[model samples]
Target chain A: MTVIKPKIAVYKFTSCDGCQLAFLNLGNDLLKLTDAVDIIHFAELGMVNPNAKVDIAFIEGSIATPHDLERIKNIRAKAKFLITIGACATAGGIQALRNFADTAEWVAAIYPKPETISYLATSTPISTHVTVDLELWGCPVNGEQILTAIKTLLLKVKPAIKRDSVCLECKRSGNVCVMVTKNIPCMGPVTQTGCGALCPSVGRDCYGCYGPSENPNTDSLSKQFQQQGCSRETIQRRFLFINNQAPAFLKAGMKK
Target chain B: MSMKMEFNNQEYYFLPHVKINALLDYLHHQGFSCIGPQIKQDAIVYEELHDSEQLPWGLRDYQMPGQYRLEENNVKRAFSWANGPQAIKPQLFKPKESLWRVARDSHGKLTFKNVTHEMKPIALFGVRSCDVAGMLIQDKAFLTEPFVDKHYQARRENVFVIAVNCGYSSNNCFCVSTNTGPQVKAGYDIALTEIDDGFVVTVGSAAGEALINKISLKHATDEMQQAMQREINNAATMQSKAMPFDNTRVVRDLLMNNLDHPQWDDVAARCLSCGNCTSVCPTCFCSSETETPALDRIESEHSREWDSCFTEGHSYIHGKVIRDDTKSRYKQWLTHKLATWWDQFDTSGCVGCGRCVTWCPVGIDITAEVAAIAKPAVDDSASE
Candidate 1:
């Protein structure tokens, strides 16, 4: 009798590569994970099998270059279930700050030869280019969440990831509301909860490492920051940081 | 021990503020976890109290829309303010609980086993009238005839409530309008009204009478009861906010009829669709279940977690999200909270504790939204 294993692939584009590292960082689970699924393509793991058909594909990063646009389409077409991991793939990561700026002018200023650099105008999410079956949010996607996503996918069930804001986790963990108590400008209310509410627990404000939480009220949070005496630059930078390209945060940051 | 104590005639009792620890001790002796309001995380939240010293004695909360702060004052009363962000919902309906488990037996056959918890009787101290009302609403939800949640029933069965009648209203509180608070008429073991020196305690249930007998409570005079009533009446009448219009029909009718109203869009523009309002709402019982399968696929566990309607996926069916836009989702939430809930539950879901108003990052007041919908009549009649 022949045994068949589900093929898995991990791909990256224009991200910091932190999200891909999370899978390897699974440590003891890495061996068990490899046993569970055939990792056909994982560049970070030194296995590079591109253009090969896979059962599941974990896509990291956003579409920043013209090549990325084409590559992502190929990935989407080949993979049965294309799961987007990390804020870059889900909502366009930090480099998405360039979405607000002129890419041509940016290239002109940064490069010695102006016309040599080739890139898209806006750093857009993977979903902007192709259908994403599941999205694991966070600057570096949570390892547990990634595992849950995989397990759910194996069962042909929709992943049970919380779309609630960081405030829920913060409250559950009994962390004081930094924005409320200290009058600090925290994005916990608008930001997603996948990061385990790291920032606010340690006495700092959430910088929205995960993209917008479900129904993110960016306007209200922005107004709160303003009331907390945050400068226009501060408010702008707060929304435009990790997940700037997120539609909700982008509008709030750009509002005034 | 099984005999139900009879003391319905002795309704009012007194507990000197200093000796309130006796009540906590008595509950502890009965193998009950005493849950009460304590100052933590910048605001007062219900926490397990091993001793009465853990209570937020001298603290008071300054609550407003989008704002909450715990300030230390000279007020010697233990339970001064109405209530905090958390209600009895988390207690009865756990935020996250393992319902059951599934595993493969030695014969390689899948076996399902229900998760059973040895739940201790929980004595909730300092619960407000509005929250008790919220619990009653939840009781209708989890304990209803069609499908009763066994998990909720098991936990709720042994719970005891020590309610606190509001001596002063919080800035956003309007339990007066809802007719659920300021003075608790039902749904408590013992209702305490804080006065000059101590609390005027009133028994509600048989368990309350038994507990009263256990603690050395003094006989309450008619004068003391009158004073407590005056204090409660003052708190009710002095409430700064209430429903701008009657919640019975007009507000519900307006919201239901004005599904396409411009006010929804206006509110949606400001609304982040953040599920904070629903999460903090005591009566919002929306939940989602998930299955966690093991690596071997032989074992799996099912769990239920709190879910909110604000999420696009909450309305997702097949391959499409029903309420795609924020405006429609917000309208759906508002309509359900005020109107549709009445039709479904045979009562209004809101208890008017003002947690939604205070906790909303944007401060989207439900009352204000209703007022905007029921504009002309509300404006004319609203005297507060």
Candidate 2:
């Protein structure tokens, strides 16, 4: 009798590669994880199979380049279950800040040769181009969430991930509301709760690392930010940070 | 000199405002960690206090919807404010705790170890009446069940409550409507009422009597007792803050009848679904359990952490989420808290400390929400 392990793959496109590092950051769990699933392809682990037919494929990063556009479609075709990890693939990442500005102007300002770049004007999420089975949200996805997602995937069950705003977890951890108590312009009320409220616990405001929580009340929080004396630009900039292209934040940033 | 003293089945004494440290010292002498509100990060948080200096004496908090500010009060009353950010919830029902440990030995047999603690006496100082009521509500939750939370039981057993009858109320207080506040009626060892020059302390339990008898306390004069009662009455009247609805019955009935009310959507548009209300709520007792397996995959520990209904994962069952929309989730939270809690616990869940209103980022007021629903529909055709 043979026990068959699920074939797993990790791929990256145009991200900072921080999301894939999350898989490696599972230091102790990484060893035990190998016993549970077969890692057929992982560039971070030095195994590079770009077209492996995998039982589970964890895709990180956004579709930035024209070539990336075609490549993600191919990966989607081969993966039985495609899971988007981090803000890059779920919502357009920090680089999606370009979406708010002119791409040609940004390129002209940053690059020496404008004609050399072959990137898309808007750095769009993978789900924008290809269908996604699930999304694990974060700036750099939480390592524990990745392990939990993988284990749950192998067991053919959905991992328990909270879609509530960070304010919930922040309060549960007994952190005084920074926006209320300290009068800081925190995005915790609108941001998803995967990071276990790491920033707010330390007396810092959250910048929506996990993208918009379920039906985030961006309108009301924006009004609160204004009442707290946050200038229009400051309120706009708050929404344009990590998960820039998330619909809720994008709308807030664009609003008057 | 231990004079035979009796007042309402226990001893009654007047503790001078300057020697309030004596009470702290007395509790400390009895092998208990004195826990009280101290200013931390601009908010009053419950922390271990070694002396009266740690208490928020001479400091008063101004709390409104979406705002909290601490200011100097020259009056120098120790228990000036009604309550703080943290309640008795964290002291008894912990935010996060390990329930038990499961380990697979060399023989491949799993061994279970219960996460237990030796009961230690905790002297909870300056606890408000609403919180004492909240603790009793939680006692019904954790103590009496087909399953009991032993960890909570252990902490609860050795608690020495030193409840503070409110000298004043904050802008957000509405405990009068909840019938849980403005005075410490029961569920305390000792109750303190702060007046102009001193504190009128009344013992509520045997332990409280023994501790008060140990200290050199002047007998509370009839005038002093009347003055204390006068202060308590003033404090109760000063709570002009009342729920917009008539009573808990009206609020509960409105929620029960108006399941599809557009008011939910109106509130949900402002509601962050952040669970801040539930987390800060003294009576919201939903929790979720998780297993933490060691790197070896053999040793594992099971733990339960505070969970809120506002979270999408909280309603997830059979591979699908029930409350997918923010409106629905908010509806479930408010309905459960105001209405169904009565069905489950024979009492309303809200104690009306108004932490939910003050702590909410958008400052969505529960009282207002309840009132909005309870209003007679002017236009029946209106839709969410």
Candidate 3:
């Protein structure tokens, strides 16, 4: 007799909804994933069963609300393994921009009456509240990554994908160095690699979609950019974006 | 892996009588789909051959530091432009199209349909060298990737490439620096160079051999070959004016080290956040899938489409976009493509294709930006 596929669930908090959709990008693989795992919950596709127990949960988005705090706890309680997908679930996400500024003033600027609104002061990743067994990073997670994550989960094996930056992928594609060939400012060196180095391939630089991976040496990259003629101010502001709150980029951004 | 076949040099003939229409007929008859350049309202596009009559002949396109426009030039041999207004990427790897969809049936069962179309053998005419290089670059991005884009894989599998050796190079072209253009290279099935009275055709693949056998080719003399070579030489010599920078190992040392530099503010101030540069590029493959809510929540389906990091929603978590600040967004984009992408994929993100340079509404030249940042590295080891 064949072993029944494991049960899996997908969760979202605050994100571009890219990671959750990653399952959909698995056009052929979605069915295969469902066949391999009983999809217990997926809000975007209206596949939700809040009470159902799950073996693994793929969480996307950041936690910026009190409700999110409680929901993540519940997800963690039921899931044997929780995997975070996309930058939002790993970093504070773009919404985390509020971390550097005053929340009340920012809310008042947008809402007619800020006092009526209720929100967390800062956006944070799922790991901040729940223990994430694995983390898949990307601005909008790449489909191949989703595939790998699912396969690893089913087999109860650690995913073998690299946590290195996008620069490695660029070199593997045999492309002429964009920064060296054209002097373009790029983040491929420090940014994580899952997006297939898309931006650089199209004649543009990477925008840190995958966030920082492993022990990224952002300081060395920053100094190199300085030598490449980047002003101190330019470097600070750029470092403050996306994964700005990430320890290394945060340190660089906060420096005078 | 090197397959060689001797060209009977004598049977390789020129067909001066074959007008654009005849060539289209010939390509079509040989079970090949033709992709030619045509004027669509205001811009010249690489689309399925609308008609040979619409070729942008006798017109010169103007491409400056950050702009591209087609202008009327009295040169009658029209088809004189070195490159098309757009690259031939969307045909093979569509820019904004769905790859798959997730849906639920009346019985409340979920089903996924991998969105792929039948591949009609394509014959891309009026080909430019940089575009070919762009194709080669994209081949690595999509075809080389582990989860292959079955759609693109199908289209590229049966395509017959007919390369037109450039007699003229454009102001926006930097293919020469990438070691790619002006003269056709190995990827092409058949490469043609325009000669004075007739054309010189060089066949490289079995499909190209089959084509030469079918088309009534004329004897190619040494003089014809020499003339074609001189034409390609002239085109190569008259390349774009920008000097490509030396970025080897620059990613490991530069942008990764100095994240505190303030040059990003200047770039952010000029950025309109209009995602044009990324969309027109040949190798960007980042995508997002969206689910359209259905009449019955139980039967909703999901569809995947293109995505851009420049957008605020791209980095959203719970309720926030990670790189909400324009400066951070722009910085994330450029740095990731140039430096970090190499670390991830083991290759440079760019192929020296200057389409991003020409297409940028703000004319954000990446090559120039890297040069702007390439200062001597400060000894940060002591600071750390």
Clashes of each: 4, 0, 116
Return the number of clashes found in candidate 3. Answer: 116
Residues B1-384, candidate 3, lDDT per residue (tens digit)? Answer: 001333333235564534556667878886777987766533456778846677776677666544566678876553567653355676776544555666767886878776665667788877776677667667767776676777777778777777778777767666666566777675677777877645688876776776666765666788888888898888778775543354445654577775666567656655544444565566666666544333223333445545556655567688676887667777787777777767766555565557677655446777666655665445556675
Which predicted model would earn the best lDDT? 2
DockQ of each: 0.48, 0.52, 0.03
TM-score of each: 0.88, 0.90, 0.56
Residue range A1-256, candidate 2, lDDT tens digits: 9988888999988899999888888887898898888899898899888987999999889998999899999999999999999998988788998887899999999999989999998999998998899999998999999887776666466666767778768767888888888889899888888898999889999988999988587888888889989999999999988888888888888898
lDDT of 2 by residue, B321-367 (tens): 89887888899988888888888888888888989899888888888
- CAPRI-style class, candidate 3: incorrect
On residues A68-158, what C-alpha lDDT tens digit does candidate 3 reach at each position? 8989998899989888888789877878889988988899999998888888999987888889888888778887777766665554566
Residue-wise C-alpha lDDT for candidate 1, range B1-384, written one tens digit per residue: 101233355467888878788888888889999888887767788888877778888888887777888787788878776667786888988877788889987898988999897778788988888888888888888988879999988767788888888888888899888878888767777889988778898887778878889887888788889989988988888788887554575667878787766787788888767677888888988887778887766789898877778776689899888997788888888888888888888878888888888877767888888888776433445687
What TM-score does chain B alone reach in each candidate, compared with the true chain B? 0.93, 0.94, 0.84
lDDT of 1 at A196: 80
lDDT-based ranking: 2, 1, 3
Could you tell me how far off, in angstroms, the CA of residue A134 lies in candidate 2 after the best superposition?
Answer: 3.1
Interface RMSD of 2: 2.3
RMSD of 3: 12.0
The ten-residue window of minimal lDDT in model 2 chain B covers B1-10
Output the worst ten-in-a-row residue range by lDDT, candidate 1 chain B. B1-10
